[model samples]
Target: MGYCRSKDLDFAFKVFEEMALKGFKRNEVAYTPLIHGLCVARRVDEAMELFAKMKNDDNCYPTVRTYTVLIN
Candidate 1:
């Protein structure tokens, strides 16, 4: 989140990938900030891809905030 907040998306993406590699449960909480950061960085296509992946995850789903991020 600090990475995302700081707009350091390269490190942010590294951390995101690390979470999956380390077997951390990827949930909405995990996906949202990266989505937000990507959106902030004008990377909407990547953000949408991530959102699609999140939706495909059995344990993950979009929240109101997630939709809000996309719409904004």
Candidate 2:
């Protein structure tokens, strides 16, 4: 969350990769903050990639709030 909030994509990606290796699953709540951070930073490409990953992942599903955050 701090990584995303600070628009630290490098750290965010590192943390995400670590989580994956550790078998820690992230859901919509996890995604929302990242999306919000990317949007805030105007890193739309990164945000979209994350969103796409969420959609492609069987474990992580987007919620209405996720869409709302992106839209707003």
What tens digits encode model 1's per-residue C-alpha lDDT throughout 1-72?
Answer: 799999999998898899889999888888999999999999999999999999998789899999999999
Structural similarity to truth (TM-score) of each candidate: 0.94, 0.82
lDDT score for residue 16 of model 2? 72
What is the C-alpha lDDT profile of model 2 across 23-54, one tens digit per residue?
88877877788888888888888889889989
Error of 2 at 42 (Å): 0.5
Superposed model 1: Cα runs more than 4 Å off: none
